[model samples]
Target: MFIDSDIKEFVEALSSKEPVPGGGGAAALAGALGNALVSMVGNLTVGKEKYKDVEPEVIEILKKAKELQEKLLSLIDEDAQVFSKVAAAYKMPKNTEEEKAKKQEALNQALKDACKVPVEIMEYSLEAIKLQRRLAEIGSNLAISDVGVGALLLKAAVLSGKLNVYINLNSITDKEFVEETKERIEKISEDAEKLADEAYQIILQKLKIEK
Candidate 1:
């Protein structure tokens, strides 16, 4: 699995011409790394006397972050799998009218299928961004910088996923599906942007970084 591979291997494959590990997979990885940081901050905060009053909340955030981390990681493989379908569809024979029709239909379906994993990645990254905002509020003070980094990564994931979705949508023929997916992307992207910025600002103020 791509997830099981080392970073160097994954990056090398990503940099290669092979299409399985593309932007969608990379987006999922970014979100997973962001959630990992969120979980780290929560782990550092929980079971600490300094944060006892908020330890319970931090524990809950930790659970959610871990869940998101797993989901995003799984999407790394899933994005690759679905995108393979897209690649296969693209290679379908289109020499004749009948073949052309079949190829177009297959490509449409493959594009739709390929969109699913990136959309899920964006949705999960939004949730992760929300968690980072809360974690930044109550997580270990020493790890606040991690929260900032997490927020930035999650934001990148969301935007990256957005681009992947749009690219697929451009080729999809079903206007209804395209419109609905675009609407969902708009809402999720907006919320992720806002929450990520809020979390970053909180981290900056906590660090007492001057504007």
Candidate 2:
């Protein structure tokens, strides 16, 4: 699995011509990194005397962030698997009229399946961003900069996931599916962008950095 591979191995694979560890996998990784940062801040704050007042909330944030981090990491491999199905569908036989019809049907299904992982990546990244926003407000001051970096990573994940969705949507012929998926992506992207920026700005203000 891509997740089991070391960073050097994964980067080597990603740099190669092979398509599985492409944008979808990269986006999932970015989201996972962002949530890991959230958990880091929570961990540093959880047992500190100064932060004891908010320890309960920090513990809850740690739980959610860890869950999201694991889910996003798993999606890195799931994205590759679904995309392989799409690649295989493209290689389907299309010599005869019947063969062409069968190939098209298989391709359409594969395209839809390929979209599922990226959509989940976008949705999960948005949730992670929400956690970062809250963490920025109450997380450890010493680790506040990590919150800014985390929010930025989550935003990148959301945008990257949207692009991956659009690329597959371009080849999909189902009008209803294309329209609905586009709507969903648009909404997720809008809210994610706004919330991520808010989280970053809060961090900037707390650090006394000029906007």
Candidate 3:
């Protein structure tokens, strides 16, 4: 698993010619790192004299942020696995009509699975960005920049996930499925952009206040 490797090893593996740890895995990893930062900001905010007023909320944010970090990290492998399945499906033999039908069926299902994995990743990224928005509002001023950085990372992850979704959707023969997935992707992409920008601006404003 990519997660089992050390940082240098993971980078080397990702840099290799293998396609398993491609854009999907990278996006999930980025989102995981982003949410970790959000958790750190919440942790930094929750136990301080100056931040007492927001401590309760920060504690809740910290709890959820930890959960999200793990969930996004898990997606890294899931994304790669599903994509691999799709790749394998494409390589299946299709010399005969029966074989062609079987291959088509497998490819359709694999593409759907591949699309779904990235959709889940985008969902997680949205959640991380929302947490970051809350952190920018109530997190400790000392680490507010972390919240901004995390929010940006989450947004980038969402966009990356969207790319994977679109590519899969284009190959899917089910128009209904493609349309449905596209709708969700568009909404998440729009909202993620809005929330990320708002959260980042809040972080910057907080830094100015601190000055």
Instruction: Give the root-mean-square deviation of each candidate in angstroms.
Output: 1.0, 0.9, 1.9
Candidate 2 residues lying further than 4 Å off, grouped into runs, are none
Candidate 3: worst-modelled 10 consecutive residues by lDDT: 202-211
Query: Model 3, stretches more than 4 Å misplaced?
Result: 209-211
Give the Cα RMSD of candidate 3. 1.9
lDDT of each: 0.93, 0.94, 0.89
TM-score for each model: 0.97, 0.98, 0.96
Give one clash count per candidate, in the order shown: 0, 0, 0
lDDT per residue for candidate 3 within 142-191, as digits (tens), equals 89889989999999999999999999888889899999999999999999
- Runs of candidate 1 with Cα error greater than 4 angstroms are none
Clash pairs (backbone) in predicted model 1:
none
Task: Order candidates by lDDT, high to low.
Answer: 2, 1, 3
Q: What is the lDDT, from 0 to 100, of the residue 80 in candidate 1?
A: 89
Per-residue accuracy of model 2 over 16-98 as CA lDDT, tens digit each: 99887999999999999998998988898889999999999989998999889889999999999998899899999999999
